[model samples]
Target chain A: MSTPIYNRVALIGLGLIAGSMAWAMKRGGVAGEIVGYARSEETRDTVRKLGFCDRVEDSAAAACEGADLVVLAVPVGAMGGVAQEIAPVLADGCTVTDVGSVKRDVIDHVAPHLPDNVHFVPAHPLAGTEHSGPNAGFAELFDNKWTIIVPVPGADRDAVARLTSFWQALGANTDEMDPEHHDLVLAVTSHTPHLIAYTMVGVADDLGRVTDSEVIKYSAAGFRDFTRIAASDPTMWRDVFLTNKDATLEILGRFTEELFALQRAIRTGDGDHLFDYFTRTRAIRRGIIEAGQDTDAPDFGRAQKK
Target chain B: MSTPIYNRVALIGLGLIAGSMAWAMKRGGVAGEIVGYARSEETRDTVRKLGFCDRVEDSAAAACEGADLVVLAVPVGAMGGVAQEIAPVLADGCTVTDVGSVKRDVIDHVAPHLPDNVHFVPAHPLAGTEHSGPNAGFAELFDNKWTIIVPVPGADRDAVARLTSFWQALGANTDEMDPEHHDLVLAVTSHTPHLIAYTMVGVADDLGRVTDSEVIKYSAAGFRDFTRIAASDPTMWRDVFLTNKDATLEILGRFTEELFALQRAIRTGDGDHLFDYFTRTRAIRRGIIEAGQDTDAPDFGRAQKK
Candidate 1:
């Protein structure tokens, strides 16, 4: 085990990412004193019981006192509130970061509230599952995942490097991008895809044409993949779209246009056109698999009823 | 090993499902011989070299001549044509079944063409991977997966029973459903979801505003899951959309309406509505996992670096 990376670390949420961060820090010995603070007493109690932190506090300010690192792990919409509450009590030279999906809004919302001596660096750990809450966290969840760090102009170098080291200790490969670029990239890669999944699942449910039982029974066909995606925590996703509206809508527009073309190909029976369109996308999957981003399993292999 | 279920079994398509079927059959000794046929010489050559079949024939008709079980393993679009070409040569009293995804259209197209003496059963082994071609198959692909059989009216009961038993021998649990219901169920469970996935991926591809690398590299965010579904065989999926039009279109319409509501909630910053909508969907995922349908791993754990 290595020495803790920070003298004191503050986690401002008790959900999946926050809990997982605490677990990773403890497992890696990447921080000296692990402190967790949630807005709820129940969550504080759970964090204490779950042993996610050496100390659990009900207020963000309480957790931030004397802390060298603070991670705001709440929904995107709550980052502003969290940053404000902790700014007053933040230890001198402390660095602030977040695990929000979209980066621009988080930077804009949280940066203004931080004290001059403290640094605010926006980050998105391209990780997590549909499951949420402290119990949903596991120490290994961050292993080999991408961690995008979006540094605002004039952000302190020492602050950035410290945060980078913290994530590196969690077994993440780190990349840096402009906060706006991060949002746009995620809008296409994460936000729109999830929205489309949610929309399609909702559509299937509302159709009322196929009995719900049939959908559930035959989910292995393909719909189950979307459900897996659609099953993601709604609050996190809802916050994503809300904060990254411009980018989300932009991707949505492009998606609708392409969908129309494919729809035309299907309607007109243009087999070659449809085939080529489908064929091009395969390279990306191959790349992902090669990059070790996904398993090559057919969508729902294990659950397939024999 | 179990006694061979058939003296010879001929698989007509050497794609992932068919290749897997051959591997499973050969490994289990469910058939003394597994012959394969493909229109493309390249595919036939690959199948032969892969050693999944005893012989790879150039023509579907030539492949089924002595084969006791003729499995039509082609795309749904080619099922009718393949059936027409092979029907005359299939051994009299031979049990004929298909591993097509859509049942009603397949039943409508293939049943009439098959000779009266040939027992026709429309069966779909709900097993597959996004990967296609002979090399992509594995012997264990169908293990624990459901195989749905939609037999024609007054079809040979013994033949249907035997076919179901054959699928069972290959490690699939078999059930029978009405063809129309099968189509409807698949539309909700598979077809519509695939369409949406294709649409979303296409949309990301068309983003003149966002670079392709951004979409692909950052895909760990959630977009990669849709791409996996989108990267499926275009010819197969196009035919799926065409054959399952009504159900798919109906589901698409419902999906669009729900999307509109979601858009409204995002525009209005109705966090409550977004939270509720997002939260309600969570139950379905829990139900699926509880029913042993999906892994609790987040989005199949796609976000992990690999």
Candidate 2:
């Protein structure tokens, strides 16, 4: 194992991302001592039993004490409160970062509370499963995934580089993006897609004519993928939509406009239009496969039910 | 192996479903001989090389001659033509079925063309991957998957029973539904979902602000699943939308209405509404897993990229 990059690393919330980060850090030896804190006592107990963290602190402040790196791993809505809670105990010159899905709102909520002595860098690791909670994490979650680091303007260059190296050592490829751009990119790639999925699943569930069993039974046709996406942590997704409102709404608007056009084409029996639009989207799937963002395996490599 | 369900099986249009049925038939000894035909010479040649079929015929009629079971495994729009072409050659008392996505449309297009001597049972195996073509088929594709059998009014009981047994031997659970209900259920579960995915992927591709590389590199977050759904066969999807116009459009209307409500929630900062909606959708996913329609495995058990 490589030498520890941070003498002490504190994770303020014990959810999927943080738990995975702790396991990854332990696997990589990227942190000398990993301290974890969760708002729920049950979560803390679960983490302690899991043994991925070196220590489970009772409070966020206690977890942050003398830590060289502090990670805010709470919901985007809770980032500011966690930041305020842990700020006073963070060691001077320690780098503070967040794992929120939306970056701009996180910076807005988190940056003001952090002390001037600390380096605040916001990062989002664009990787997760439909599962959540403390037990949902694995060391390999972030392997070969992209972790976009959104550094505040005029931030310490050394701190940024160190955080990048830290993520790299934890098995992620790191890139720097401005917070606004990061939010917009994630709006297109993550937030809006998730909202659309949730909407579709909700629509299916609300339909009185189509029984719930029918929707669930026939889901493998296409709806199961939407169900998987919609099943992601509700609180996390709520916070995501609340915080990333502007970008998510903007992308949703575009999505609806395009959807309406396709809906019209279907109504009008415009076979050529529907065919061309569908044919163009296949190129994008090909690009995703070629970029190694997803496996080319049929059905996302899902095991056949037998 | 069990007794053969049919003496000879003719598969019209040797694509994914037909090729898979050929393999599954071979695996279970469901048919004495499997004869395949495709409109394209390339597909027939590929199926011959794949060795999934006992014989590859140049024409649909030749393939249907003397066959006790004939499957119209073409696009929804093409089903009528194939049925008409094979009607004259189909043996007396032969049972004919289809693997089309839309049931009512296939029935309207194909039923009138079939001779009274043969049974026209429309069956749709609610199983497939984004991949298509002859090479995409596997024997396990239908294992433990549901196949909805839509029998025409006055369909011969013996023929229906034999066809259901044939599907069961090919590794599918069979259920019977009327054409109209099957169309409506599939519109909610599959047709509208595919259209929405295609529209969303098209919208992402159309956005100039979000570079293609950006959308692709970060797709693992959620957009990749949309890409997979959108990447499905263009011709098949186009025909599906055109033929199942009313039901798909009805579902699309409901989808857009639900989407607008959620969009309003996001814009109005209605976190509780968003949270409740998201939470409700999670139960359907749980039902799907419990029903054995999908795996509880994280991320659908996708293999981690190293």
Identify the candidate with maximal DockQ.
2
Candidate 1 docking category?
medium
lDDT minimum window of 10 residues, candidate 2 chain A:
A297-306
Fnat for the candidates in order: 0.61, 0.86
Tens-place lDDT per residue, model 1, B180-250, is 88887787778877877777776667667677766766777777778788778888887887787776666
Candidate 2, superposed: residue stretches over 4 Å from native: A303-306, B303-306
Interface RMSD of each: 2.4, 1.1
Candidate 2 structure quality by residue, lDDT tens digits, B57-154: 99999999999999988999999888888888889989899999989888988989988888888899999999999999989888888999998888
Shift in Å, residue B161, candidate 1 = 1.7
**By TM-score, how accurate is candidate 2?**
0.99
DockQ (C-alpha) of model 1? 0.56
lDDT of 1 by residue, A1-306 (tens): 797788898889889998888888888999899988888888889889999899998677888899888889999989999888888888878888999988888888898898898888888898777778888887877787789999999878888988898899997888899977888888778888888777766666665666555566566667777777788877788788889998887777677777767667666766777677777777777777777766766663343322
DockQ of each: 0.56, 0.83
- Top candidate when judged by TM-score against the true structure: 2
Clashing pairs in 2: none
